[model samples]
Target: MATFPQVDFLKEAGLKADRILVPSDADFVARQASYWSCGARSLRPACIVQPRSAREVAAAVRALVSARVPFAVRSGGHTAWASANTIGADGVTIDLGYMDWVRLPSDEEGTGKTVNLGPGNQWGRVYSELALHGLTVAGGREGNVGVAGLILGGGMAFFTGRYGLACDNIVEYEVVLADGRIVSARKDGDHANLFRALKGGSGNFGIVTNFRMRTLPLPPVWAGMTIHPKEAIPDAIRALKDFTDDMWSDPDFKDIVVIGALIQIAGVEQAPAYKKWLEMPTITTTCKMTTIPQLTMDYSQAKDYHNTWFTATFKNDVRIVAKAAELHDQLVKTLKAFIPDGDFVTQCLFQPFPRLFGQHSAAAGGNMLNIERQSHDGLLWLAVAQVRTPEQERFAYTLVQDWVHAVRQFAAIIGGNLEWTYLNYADRSQDPLTNYGLENILFMKDVAAKYDPEQVFQTLCSGGFKVSNVKLPN
Candidate 1:
């Protein structure tokens, strides 16, 4: 017998039966299975609430908070972390995937500089819709990443070189407060503190329903992947060294080398910056002039894997990159010994993170990433291992942990370590909030208390990087 009171309370709170799903419901099973991570899919939420509008989300929040039920807010449910979006049978999941709408501003809405996005939207659909008007926003680089998670984590976008992070470009957030009050948090508004806190502070303040984001003109881009052979690693590394900024390099763990790219040089088919990489040999090259939406579709991944990911930041030194690759080899060896075949993919990606990005953020209402503190260019390094089965997931977790530790130690030895740990790629075990610095931490805490007096989001709303978990003064 399902004894979870959340279902009844949700119904009593005016949410339609169709909007709520229990373990007994077939749609509930399908909804749970829809999460990108098999680990998340395995969990059993007592009921999953599919809120189609802000008012519906508010009602759910009110019911769940009043009843003292632990709940989680899920947007797109793309993360591989088990508890990130899904909860145990004791809780409910506020799956916002149905609220996936995008709209350009009418004359009555604010300046045409911004567009409204639903929290449930995935970047690919968002990009495709926006591209219809020859426009886009500084959103997620990967198409499948949820708009909410990416923006809340201080998103790294395709146009980060010219603009800043996805968070930096947010003009306003229509957030449902802990007390079920719907409010708009914007730079020019009365709730300005909450506005900044929600940027990089993550899903601790409120459940955002609509994201009003600054839009940019999307032009044709010269982009795509270029796969390198195993023997060309040294040469590829050289080319990367010479390049100012390129697509994130994802060399496969199998050691059959690959350098997949989705880089864009706006308004031109070819840029001199990529000359070094273009000169190198490769197995496959998809580099061509294409739209951002088309390029993003090419980068979407299959959701059938048990995944473990960890990240760290370091100086943009070739030694650190080389050391990371060496340690990745060790990790791959250990993982193969444990799993011994089947489907497994590992990546050691180093994305370009320049310090000036912070300046760009500051110019546009600012974000909490705090990477601007670094006066030089850096690399946001991500180590990912996706495999089959829970057993493989556990083993891969340990292996990836060791690899990240080894890489950090090597960075320390070479004095190549940096402070910022981007929340988007961060593992659940990591504390990316503290990396935002003391000022930002204090600012977020104050905002959390002011907006959520009872600390509903901090205490009851489970999942995501919580501001309550930090040791800083509240």
Candidate 2:
């Protein structure tokens, strides 16, 4: 095992002694070994540095860069890929869990309120905290997801139909650049370009220490999950398409449909479609007129299993969705036959990415997703599988890869294939940044060069998708 060369330097510097944990320390061993998703739990870093503030993070960055040692920054440890948030054997891990802070500002001018959040905070805590003040921000549907990774990678939320993505709600970002400089990027600030790049650019630019997001009033929401048997897939597909097609006119309806061994529909219940879907032969779990915090709390899934996610985007066509359902059924059978001993379950989810979502973002400051450039409203497809062990992961990966390819082919056949991909749900094997469209990719590269001229983030970060690998158009 390789050692972190800057461990001693970081300790000798102003960093607190207790904050730096070596592999020998029990706390370090536990934090290093634990991950929200099992796929990254196997990675072991040489040392773990928990920074309590952005200044400490900057100090750690300076020491690591001076010593030329590789390091990975982890916010919530929710990424499912190995080494995506966890460091390899030779690297150091900057765990920002201690920086979890959420507060409402005392001074503000507008009709709405803005909440300040720490990157280390989880969406569950943020939503819960803000709900006390009768406010909520656009955030991940799943509560356990971290604020930093999701916002940086273009987040999707139930409120995305009303507001845009989670990133679109960000008013300011306090970031630590490659040169160990801490700067604030706001829409009207000098670092505006960097601000836009950070919207969907992943971890390639810099480490965001803090996020200040605009919050909406906490409205009473009616939401829940409905389970239908496999026989309902065709009807479910048609229903979903009809709902999404109508979303342009009806912006209040938000839904996420999952097709697999069973069909699951989870979303806002106020939509008439929800009532109609509930009428089908199904097991319904209903939550009516609740706050955002309570809704997310109710829908939180278990994180104990090894998870894999792959995603694709296509036009909102019922034909394509039906084809995807067939592929999902076939993939489940193949997984059972290949890995009978593994505890594996598959999920194929379709969510509306209506043109209205993009229009909302455009109304706010634009983002790197460039959804406005797309010609039509679409559905974002995610193929997810979970297993219990490392050995099972291999079989799960192969199964998911094949399923994604089949879905892509189906979309192409229907002339509905979309170049855009939702980065938050994409697997490591997929190139989501390149699919952001050629112009956005080029703009992101320019921003990377401008903010990190030494290519420190591009070369040294070594986690998440890097802008350097984006392919240029011919």
Give the Å error, residue 276, model 1.
1.0
Output the TM-score of candidate 2. 0.94
User: How would you encode candidate 1's per-residue C-alpha lDDT over 308-330 as one tens digit per residue?
Assistant: 88999887778888888888888
lDDT string for model 2 (1-474, tens) is 544556787876678889888877889868755677887878777788999999999999888877777899999888878878887767788899989999777687534578889999888998888877777888877788889999999888767877888999899999999999999999899999999999888888889999999888777666656677777777788778777777755565556585311111233445564545665677654545566676666766677788889999999999898888888878888878877774676778888888888898888878888897778989988888988888788878888898889888878987999888788888888888887777788889999999889888887776888889887877
- Backbone clashes in model 2, listed as residue pairs: none
Collision count for each candidate, in order: 1, 0
Q: Where does model 1 exceed 4 Å of error? A: 1-3, 108-112, 245-262, 265-267
lDDT (0-100) at residue 178 of candidate 2?
Answer: 90
